[model samples]
Target: MKHRDSKDEEKVYKINGSTSSMGNNRKKKKNMQRLGGTGLSLEAFANAKSMSNKYNPAFKKKQREFYKNAKYVSKYKQSLKQQSQQIDAFSAVRPIEDQNRTRDVDEKNIKNKNKKKPSMEELYKKKREEEEQARIEREASIQAKKVGREKAEAERKATRAKMFKKTKYGQPVMKYRIEHLLQTIQSSSRISVNNSN
Candidate 1:
């Protein structure tokens, strides 16, 4: 390789020169002093603020109670405002025809309320009737379920008896096995005949 020229060498050195000592020429910064009017040291001032009577327990308790009461009052007022708004909206949506109908219904309700109350015997009879009707429906549902269960049990019994039947020689019955064998033989014969054709 050819040696670098002096001008080129100087240019390379300037580009790659170390800048580690560049900051050393800057003046050292001095810490700022805190101005104090209270004749106390730094630690003492900090501790004094923490122990100040302005934040005593009694004052904090009173502030907490005041805030709690204010929160409850605001919540109650908001609820009342919402209820009034809902009532206003409901009344506004009622048409004149509905208002008349509602008035008639209200009059009927008032008249019913003014009428003589049912005697105790009549009330008891109505209650008994309702209870008897409920009991009848419940009994009907239970009977239906019982009948369904009996039907399922009979079917299961029939299937099990068919599958587990035994001959006089104490050998298990093989009627289903013979039928399966016959079907398989017929299928094989049909396949063979088709292949021959």
Candidate 2:
């Protein structure tokens, strides 16, 4: 079917329960744009505020407190900046402690440089002490080695004398042939052990 007007057609074919107020409000709001703070006037805002009765006592108190806190924060920032500047100045100039330390080190170096060198008598005394100590240690080691060797030699002689005393030729004949008999016994022992292995 052809419609005489699109508006009438829409009205006739509208939903069974839909309202026209929603459509009318959407069209009206779209035609009007809010110009808020872009066109705001100080005089208009002042008049509006004077006419409004929405003031609360707590709001005034909070505004005053915020102003006081902002002032304190700005003062604190200035103090910190001043303290940092002072620190920079202090660092640029060397402190007395560092100057004293450097002076002390220089003085100590001078004192050490001017110190006396060792005398010939001192050098001779040190050399003699070192040589004496070395000689004493060598003598002790030699004495201990001599005692050990002497003990071992005594034991070997005693063993040979015992072996000779056991010989069939008797103790008297053993005196003459003891050295030769001992050498033969040692050689025979070595040969027997080797052959057995």
The best candidate by lDDT is 1
Query: On residues 21-55, what C-alpha lDDT tens digit does candidate 2 reach at each position?
Result: 65777766766555322444899677767865576
In candidate 1, stretches whose alpha carbon ends up further than 4 angstroms from where it belongs are 1-110, 176-197
Clash number for candidate 1: 0
Count of clashes, each model: 0, 0
> What's the TM-score of every candidate structure?
0.32, 0.34
Off by over 4 Å in 2: 1-96, 167-197
Cα distance off (Å), candidate 1, residue 177? 7.2
Error of 1 at 168 (Å): 4.6
Task: Provide the RMSD of all predictions against the true structure, rounded to 1 decimal.
Answer: 14.0, 27.6
